[model samples]
Target: MDRKQIINDPQTGNKGEAFEAYDDIPANPNLQRTIGDVIAARYGRRELLKGILGVSATTALFGATALSAPRPSAAAVSPEQGRYNFAELQWGNDETHHVADGYDADILLRWGDPITADAPEFDVMNQSAEAQLKQFGYNNDYVGFVPLNEEGSRGLLCVNHEYTNEEVMFPGLGRQDRADFAGMTRELVDTEMAAHGGSVVEIARGNDGKWQVVRDGKMNRRISPLHTEMTIDGPAAGHPRMQTSADPTGTRVIGTLNNCAGGMTPWGTWLMAEENFHGYFWTDKLDEDGKPDLSEQPEAEQMKRYGAPGRWYAWGKYHDRFNIDKEPNELNRFGWVVEVDPRNPDATPVKHTALGRFRHEGAETTVSSSGRLVVYMGDDARFDYQYKYVSDGVVSEDPAANARLLSEGTLYVARFDEDGSLTWLPLVHGEGPLTAENGFASQADVLIDTRLAADALGATPMDRPEDAQPRGDGTAYVMLTNNTRREADQVDAANPRAESSFGHIIEIKEAGGDHAATHGHWSILVKCGDPALAEVGAEWNPETSENGWFGSPDNCAFDAEGRLWVSTDQGSGWGKTGKSDGLYGVETEGELRGHSKLFFRCPVGGELCGPYFTPDNETLFLAVQHPGTDGTKALKGFERASTFEDPATRWPDFDPKMPPRPSVVVVTRQGGGKIAV
Candidate 1:
C-alpha cells in the first residue's frame, strides 16, 4: 500500500471521516476571516450586553434568573450546595500531573492493577491474557464514581479502558511495523483483547479523605473482551445484519471493544460507548489461496466512510472472529452503547440498539419535563453528526422498567441552521427519505445504516463531536473537537474556524426547557485557542489575565453549580510546544461568566480525560491517557519506544528507569474543603 494514499485518504488518516468531503468542496473567500474578525463578528455585541448585565440574554430568556445574581470572587462553596471557586494555574510540559496550588492529587489506579484475588501482580516483562482479564484494563478513559452507602465513603469506581497503546503494552513491541506481524503470538493478541473493556472496582474513602481500591472486594470485576458476554437489545437486536456464525441468534456478543467516554444513568448503570472498534479487525485479510476476500463486501463504501482501513492491526491472524471477510456481521455487533449495573455483578450487560450506532462517544442523559428519558450522544468520527435518543415511555423508579426504556426510543440526528437554531432530524423508518425505496427496509435497517440515513436527510456534518453534556437548567453543551481538515467553504456559524486547529464549544438551549424538544437554539460558548496568538484566541482576551486559553476540548462535565469543566486531547501536535494537555474550569454564570482557568495539566504526550466530580463536588477524578507517547519522535530526548529499556515517560512512578503507564488521578483540596473553592 502506498503511504501517501493512506495519508491522503480521509478514512485512513488522522482526520478520519470528518474530513471525507473536504476535497470535494472548494474554498469560500467570503467565509474566511481573521481570528479577531471572527470573534468580534460572532460575540462582540452579545458579550457586550452580557458583560454589562453579568448574564447572557439567552440565559435570561430561558428564565434562569439565579445565574444573574451577584456572588463572591473567592473560591468558596457552601457545604449544602456544591459550588466552584475560581483558581488559575500556569501551563507546563512537566512529566507529572499538575493541580491547582491549594489542591492535592494522587494516582488512584494504574493499568494492570490486580482487582481480583485470581489476578497476578503486574509484571511488565511477563504479562499474560489470564492475568490481564483479572486486572484493570489499559488506557482508562471515562471515570464514574457511584456511592454504595449513604455517607458516600464507599462506592464503585467504574472506568472505561478505551484502547491499548500496543507499542507500550507488550515488552518488546517497539513501534508497530509490518515486519512485527510475523513475530506476533497468540498470547500477545489475547493480552491485547483482554485489555479493551471496562472495570468495576469497590473503593473506600479513608479518614484522611483519600480513595483506595479494595482488592478482591465483592464488587471488584473486570469486563474484558476475552470472556464477558453481552446481550443485544432494542429493535435491531435480531436483525439479519447482526447475525453471525458464532451466534446464529444475532442477540449475543462475546464482549465490548474500545469502550470510551461514558456516563452514569439516573438509575445508576454505566453507559459505555464503543468507539474506534473498526480498527481492531482485519477486513481485507488474505484467504488460504492468498486472495483478498473482503473485495465483495456489500457495505464496503459505508465501511470506508466509518474509517475501516484494510488491516491495520491484523488481529484476524490470531482470531477468526476478528476477520471481517470471514464473519462480516461480527463488526456490526460492536458499536452500540453497552449498559452495565455495577451493583449487580451477575446482571447481564446490554447493548441498546435504540440509540442507533456509529462511533459512539457516550450517552449523557437527562429527563424531560414530560418525564421522558432523553439521551444526548456524539459520533466521535470527523464530519459525523450529533444524535439523541428520546424514549417513548416515561422513566420509572423500578430499575428493570427503566432498563427497557432505552430499547424503545427514537434516534435523531442534528442539523444546525444558519440562524443559531438547530433541528433534530428523526432517523425513523418510513419517515421522509428513510423508506424502503431508499434502501431502509425496516427500523433495524435505519438504525444499522444510521450515518447513510442522516446523509440522505441532508443533516449537517460537524467537526468531530466528542461529548454532549446536559446541565440541570435545561441546556446542553457539545464539544466539537478540532477539525484540521475543515475548508473555508465548510465554515458555518457554529463551526466558524476554517482549518480549526483549536475547537469550540456550543451551548444548546432545548426548546421550552424540554430535553425531548425537536427544535433548539444554540450559540458558540467559547472559540478555544491560544489567547496570546492573534489568529485564534478567546474572545475575552484570556491571555492578559490568569485565565489561560486551551484547544481541542475532548471530554467535558458540569460541576454541581453548573460550571463547565473541559479536558483536552491534543493529538500529534503534543510536545512541540511547552503546553501539555490539561483540565480547565469555566464559569457559565454569575459575575465570573465566560472566564476560564487552567486547573490541572497532564504529563508530556498525555491527553486529559474523564473529568468527573463527586456528588459533593469535593473530589475531582480524571484519567491521564498515553503519557510520553512520542512514538519515535525524540522530543526533549524522549524516544517513543514502548520497551522498558528505552521508555519515553516514567509517569506515576517518577523513577527514571521505569516506563510510563496510564493511570487515574484523584484531586481534592488540601484543607478538607470543596475542590476549586
Candidate 2:
C-alpha cells in the first residue's frame, strides 16, 4: 500500500471514505447537533479561559515569572506545577532524539532486540521470521511498565508493535516496489507478519539508574501474528460471524494484528487494541466462482464502513486467512481489545468482545465510583465515535475475578450535546434502532456492528479520536487527532473545526466524578495548530508560541502529579513546518494552566508514542517509531530507489550508514531527583 498516498487523499485518508459511506444514514433526531452548537456558542470565550485556568486573573497568573521560575512545593501547588519545569526543546530535523537540557535519554531497546536466550542478536542483513518472533517487533506504540518490586528495580515492559514499514523491513523493496505484491516472496510476507504484534520483556533499573532489558528473564515473551493463541471471549465469541475453518468453534483466533495504543489493566494485564486491522485483509477480490466475493457478503456494508479495502498489504497471497474471499469470516475475528498477561508467559491471551469491535486505538480503564471497571476507548478513524464499556460486576480484589470483568459489560457510544454535556448512548441489542428488525439478532450482532449501532444512535462524530485517558482527578482527556476531510456541515460544538488539520484535546469531567457516569460535561483543552491560521468564532485559541505549538496529538498520559503529557504522530505532514514529531507537556491546572511546552523531538519522519511515566515520576518512557520513513519518494511507476545507501535516520545508532531502528527511549533528570522538579 502507498501509505503516503493514502494519507494525502482527502476522501480516503484517515478513514475518510468510511465516514462518507456512513454519512447518509440518518442520525437519531434526539441526538442531533443542537446541543453541541449551544455549548460552543455559550462557552466559546467565557468557559474557554475558566475551564483551563480555573481562575479569573489569567494574565497575572501566566506572567513571565510563572514560565521562568521553579514551581512551588507539591502541597502548596496544583498538579501541573513542577511537572513541566524543563525548558522547551527547539524544533529540528536532526536524526536523533532531543530531550530537555537537564535530562538525558538513551535507547532501551530497538527493533529486533533479542527478548529470549534462544533469540539471535539483531543482524539487518540476515533477518528471518524465526528471529523476529524472538525479538522486539516493529513500530512500537503503546508502552506499559509494570513494576515487579517496591524498589522499582525490576519491571515488565509491555510494548505494542503497531505495524511494519515493509519498505524499510526489506533489503531491496521500497514503497513503489511494494505495489507489486504478486512478485513478492512468501518468506518476506511471513517475516512481515512476524513483526506485527506486541512484546513483553523484563527490564531492570541499574544502580546507576539506567534501564536495560533482561534478556534471560523468565517473563520475557513475544506475541506475534505468526504464532499465538488468542481465545475469543464475550458476546461475540462463538457467534457465526467469527467462525472460520481453522476455528469451527469460533472461540479461538491465531494472533493479534496492528496492536496500537494500549493500557494496563488493574489486574496486571495488557489490553492491546487492534487498530487498522482492516488494512491486513483483502476482501474485494474474486472468489472461486470468479465473482467479487466482498459484494456477496452479508456484512459488506458494515465492512466498508470499517474501511475494508479491495487490496491492501496483499498478505492474502501468502496466507489464506488474510484473503477474505477464501476465509470470509477471518476478518471478523480481529479488531478487538486483546488482553495479554505479561507476568505469565504461559497464559493464553484473550480477545475481549464485550468492548465492541471497531478501529480501536486502545482501551484505558478507570474505576467508577460504584466500583465497576470503566473502560474508555476510541475508534481511531475520522468521524468515529468514542466508546466506553462498564462492567456489570464490581471490581474484585482477586485477580482471577477481576480478569473476567471485561467479558460482561454494557457498551455505549458518546453523544456530545450543545450545552457542553455528553451522553453515553447504549449500543445494546433491542435498544432503540438496534432491534432485530434492523438486522441485530442478538447482543453479539450489535457488538459486531458497533459503528453502525453508534451511527444509528446519532453519536457525535469526532476528529479521529485516538487515545482516551482518565486522570486521577476523575476527569478523562481524549486526543482528537487531525481530520482533514471533515466538512463544515459535520462540524459541531464539540468538533468545532471543519477541517481539523492540527487537532485538539478534549477534557471530560464525568458527572458526579464517576468513570461510569452516563452523562458528563466536556471542554476543549487546547485547539492545537499554528495560531496564525486561527479562524473567527473559534471556541479556544490556537497554539501561538513557537515553544508550544504542535499538531496531530496521538498518545497521551498523566503523570503522578496529574500533569498531561502528549505525543504527536505527524504521518505525511512530517517536517512540513520544519518541526518534527515530539513529546510535549501541558499544564492542565494551576497558574501555568493552558501552557504547553515541547519536551522532546523525534528523529526525521518518526512519531513519538507511549509517553508513560513511572509511579515515582522519576522516569519517562517513549517509543520512537518509523524514523527515516521519508527517505524515499513515491514514483509514477512501480519503481523507486533509496535516497541514500542507508535509511535517512540512524537515530539511536548515530551511524548514517546503519539502518534506522525504531526503539524505546528512557528519559530522566540528570541530577537524579524526581523528574521535572
Candidate 3:
C-alpha cells in the first residue's frame, strides 16, 4: 500500500519515510496528480445504458463463454516451481516459507499462545501493557473460517494483525522514535495495539486432522484498536461528521485500523476491513483555535480522501489523542466496515455505518432468496472507488435474525457501463443526486464524502479495488491494484489504461443472479500485463493477457476447486524495467490452461498477504508480513534482520534462534492431491 505521496511535507507528511533510517520511499516526485483529468473533465459523458441493460441481460443467458473460462491444465505451475524456488525460506526464527514443496501439514501460531480464558503469555523480553492486550497478538493477517454446520462440522478462526513489530514485537533491538506514552508504559504501545486489530480464535480439528488454535476456546476474543467497541453503521450513522464526546450519537466508533483483507457473512458474521485507516491519526494545526490553519478543511479534501488526517500517527511525542486537531472524531473513527460476531464473544465490534469510509480493502458477502444482502467492497487506495452495501434490513434466514442485518444497510456506488456493465449507485438517504443540490447535505454527507459522493454519483474510478472474490457462479472477482496514475490522456471506458503499470481483474455479472443487483455485467475478466510485451495485444484489446503476467495485482482468492490466487503489489512500470513481487496461481477452470507461474517470493522484506483456502480444499492459510523489514537498524541474534535461516525453512518447528516471526502458516495436501496446482 505504498504509492501514496500526498506530502506537502509536514515531517514527510505523517508516518512516511517508513519510520526513518535510510528513508527514501515517499518520493512523491510529483506531477502525477491529475485527479484523473479533473475527474474526467468535470463529469460530462453519460450513457452506459446500464451497461447496455447489463450486457443485454447477461449476454442472452451466459453465452459469453461463461465469461471466458476454459484456460487451465498447464500442470498448474510445476508443483510450485518444484517446491519453493522463489526464496525467503527461513523456518527456525519462528516461521516463514513462500511455500516449500507443495504442503501437507505445516503449523505455526506463535507470538504468545493462549487464545483466551483471558490470553497473555509470550514475553519477548518483559512484554506487558495489559499483557499485550490479552495475547495471541503480533503479526497475523486475514484468515477466515466459519463452518460449524452443513457437514463442514465446526469452526470460528478470524485472524488479522496487519501491523506492528518494533524489532520483532518489541523489547528493543533498535527501536524508533521511542516515545513510550504509557498506554499502559508502552511495550511499544502494547505491541502496537496488540498487533493492530483482529483475533476471534476458537478453532478445533486436530488429532492429526489439522486446524488447531483453540487454546481455551469458549469463543476466544481480542478486538483492540486500543480497546474495541465500534458501532456506527450505514449512511454515516449519526453524522455530525461522526459526532462524539464518546459517541453522543456519532454512532459509536473506537477501534480497528489497517485490519486488511476480510469477508464472511451469510448470517454467520465476520467482515473486517479498515485498511490503512489513514495511518492512525495525528493532525493538530492548533484547531481548537489558539490559531493555526494549514489550508484545506471543510473536511480537508474529504479527510484526505479517506486516510483521514485530523492528525495521523504523530508518533514522536507519543500519545495524547494521537492529535487529530485534538480528536476530530479520531480520524472519523477509522474507514468503516468492522462487523465481527464469531458466535458472540460478548459481541460488540461494529462500525458498519453502511460501509462508506474508504481505504477498506475487503467485505464480500452474498445473500438474497428474498433477504437482500450483497456486500462486496474494496478501496485499497490508488484511483479508488468500487463499493456495494445494499441492506435496508432484509436478512431473515435467521441465524438469529441474520446477525441483525449487518446493522442496517444501503450504501452503493459503482458505475462502469460501456459495453461491460455495472451500476449500483445508491449511497441512500434521499437518493439520486443525494441533496442540498448534489453537494450532498445529508445521509451523513453521502456516507462521509464517499469519494466526493462517488464523484457526484457517477462512480467507476477503479484500478485499485484489491480483492472481492465470489465466483462459485455468481460472479464477482475484482482486484485491480495497479494504476501508475493512468496517464496517456487519462484513459476511460471505466479506466481503460493510460499509465497502467500492471493490474486488472474485474468480472462482475450480478443482475438476476442478484447480489441484490442495482445493476451489473462487467468484463475484462483478467488483464494483468507483462507477457514479454508487444503492446500486450493493444492494451488487452479483448481479453487474453496471461503467461506469468507480473506487477501489482494484490490480494485475491478462489481455491476450493476454482483456482485463481494472484497476489503481487509494488509498483513502477512493469518490466519495461524492474520491480518484482510474487505469488500467482491462475487456472480459472478446466484443462488447467491459463497457467501463470511465480508462486512465492516476498522475503526481501515481504508483501504477499491473506491467501486463505481450507474449506476441505485442504488447509493453506499464509500471512508472513515484514520479514527482516529492510529498513534496517533492528538486528540481534545472528545479526537479525531475519530470513529465518538454517537448513532453509524449518520455521518454529520449535524455534531456532527467534526473530523472523510474523507467523500463521498451515498449508496441507502431501499425497492428498489437488493443492498447489
Candidate 4:
C-alpha cells in the first residue's frame, strides 16, 4: 500500500495508530546495508545462541567479543532459577484487566476524575475545557512518585497524559482526522490542549494500606498545553530559530504537549519527555492528495526531517502559534525534556536544550559512579538514534545545586558495531563534520537541528528505540520496538530481522562501570516473540511458558532489586500475538537469563505503560491508556469502530453512563508486604 492509502485506510482505528502508519517512512537517509546482508556475511556462534534468536539470526547482535566478557554478578546456572517468586499470570484477551493471583489491582485515578477539592465531578455529556483543566488528564502514560514524608507512605504522583482519543473520548464526534477534521470545534481542540502534558497530585497511604488522593493537598496542580507557561534553558535557549512573534525573547514558551515516558531525577524533579510533537502542528496548505504542503516553507527541509505539520490535531487551525504558516519556529521550541518541580507548584518548568530534540520516548536518569548525572534516552521512530547526556557538574547533597545538571550536559549519540563494541560519538559543533560547511554554524545550531547533526556524525540508526532504563551498576537496557516497514536491504546487525514483527532488547554495560563513559559493550538480552516459531527467530529461556513471551517492548523499568520489568504496546497488531498487552518480568542475569513471566495484563485495546515500583517494592503503579478503542477491530466478536457512546467495555467504573476511561492502576500484595518476596 502507498503512504497515503495506509493512513487513509478504513482499518485505521485512531489518528495515533494512523500516525504510526504515517511514520513507517523513516526520516533517516542512510540505508546502504540491510540486516540480511550482514547476517549472511558473518556466520560464527550462530548455534550457541540458538537458545535466543535461533539459527535464522546470526551472531551479529550477540558476538563473542561482548558475550565473553564477565557476566552480571547475579547470573544463574539454569533457566528455571531466578529471583522473582510470583506465580505467572496466564495471558488472554478480555474486556477487563487481570493481575497475578496474590495481588490487588485497584483503580486509583481515571480520566476526568476530580483531582482538586473545588473541581466538579466529571460529566462526560457536559464536558468543557474549563472543567478538564482541573481534573485528571486523559491517556495517562508515565507514573512517578516523589516521597513527601520519611516513611514513604505519603508522596506526590506525577503522571503524563500522552494524547487524546477523540473517537472514544468524545460524545458525537467520530474519527476526525479521516474526515478532514470537520467535527473538531474550537472547544474540543481547547479541551484536548488542556488534557495534554502532565499532572501532579498528593497521595497518602491509609491505615488499610490503600493509597488515596489528597484533593485538598497543597501540591495538587495540573500542567497543560493550553495555559501552562514554561521557560527554556541550556545552549539553544535564546537562538534566533526559537524566537516567535508572541515570544520575542525566545527564552519562554507556553505549555508542553505529547508528554510520553518520563523520569524522576535523583533530586526530586520530573522529566517530561516530548514525543510526536510533529503531529500536533497544523498547516493550511495541502497537496492534491490532502497531505501537508511544505514546498514554500522557509524551514521546509528541517521541518520535513522531523515530519512537522503532521496535522494530527486541529489546534493549529484554531490557534495561530500552532499554525506553521504564521510561526514556523514554534515547532522548534518543543521536542525537548521539560523538568518540573513536584514539591513546589509555583516553580516554572524548564526545557533543557542541551538534551537534543527528537521524538524522545523516555528520559530516564541515573547518577554515574563518579556522581555526574547521566540520562539515557531513545528517539521513538523507525530508524532514529539513541542518545546519552552526561552532566559536567557532579551531584551534591544540595537539591538546588543538582537542578542545573541537565542544562550543562554533553550530548552523545550511539554507534553500535558488529564486534559488540559501542562508541559514543559527541555531537559537538566545530568538531569533525559538525562545522559551518555541514550546516552547524554554532553549538546552538547543532542543538537546534539535533537529528541533522547526528546524521552527519555517523550515528547508528536503530529499530525504534524506546524507554531506556539505566541501573545503579551502570548497566542500561534499551527496548527496540519492532519496525515492520523495514525492507530486505535496509536491515543491520543491531536490527537483524527484515519486516520485524517482534522487537528485541539490548543490554549495555558501560565501560569501567561508568554511565558517563565514552564506550560500552552491548549484547542482545532477548529477541522477543513466540518461542514456538523458529522462523520468528525468538529466543526465550526454556522455563518461559506460553504466556511469558511478548512483542513490541515499549516502556521498561528496574525494580528495587534490579529486576527488569517491561510493558508492551502492540496497538492493532496485538491480534498477531493473540494476547492483550501487559507487564512482564524478564530475567536479565545468571541462569534464568531471558526467562520471562507475565505479572499483569491489560484489557482489550489498552496499552500498558509506566510500570513504576516504590522504593520499598511494596507498591506497583501502572497506567492503562485508551482502553476499549485501540484495536477493537481485531477483537473476536466486536469487529467495528468503538465510539464513546458504544464502547466495547466500560472499564474501572463499568457504569453504563460512563465510557472506558483511561486510568492509573495501583497494584499491592494481599497482605501488605514487599511484593513477590
By TM-score, who's the top model here? 4
Q: Which candidate should be chosen as best, given lDDT against the real structure? A: 4
| Preferred candidate (lDDT higher): 1 or 2 | 2
Q: Tens-digit lDDT track for model 3 on 132-164? A: 666666667677888766645357778777666
Clashing pairs in 2: 35-417, 35-418, 36-417, 36-418, 39-418
Model 3 bad stretches (over 4 Å): 1-120, 123-129, 134-139, 142-223, 227-239, 247-254, 262-359, 362-414, 420-434, 437-439, 442-444, 447-452, 455-504, 507-594, 598-662, 665-677
Worst lDDT window (10 residues) for model 4? 71-80
State each model's CA lDDT, in order: 0.73, 0.74, 0.58, 0.85
Kindly indicate the candidate among 2 and 3 with the higher TM-score: 2
Clashes of 3: 28
lDDT of 4 at 333: 97
Per-model root-mean-square deviation over C-alphas: 5.9, 5.7, 23.5, 3.8
Residue 641's lDDT within candidate 2 is 27
lDDT of 2: 0.74
The TM-scores, one per candidate, come to 0.87, 0.88, 0.32, 0.95
Error of 1 at 654 (Å): 2.6
lDDT string for model 4 (431-524, tens) is 9999999788899889888999988887777889999999998899999889887765554445666688788898899999999999998877
Model 2 clash tally, residue pairs: 5
Instruction: In angstroms, give how far residue 25 of model 3 lies from its true place.
Output: 41
Residues 194-284, model 1: lDDT tens digits:
8879899998889998989899789889897779999999989989999999999999999898888988988999999987776676755
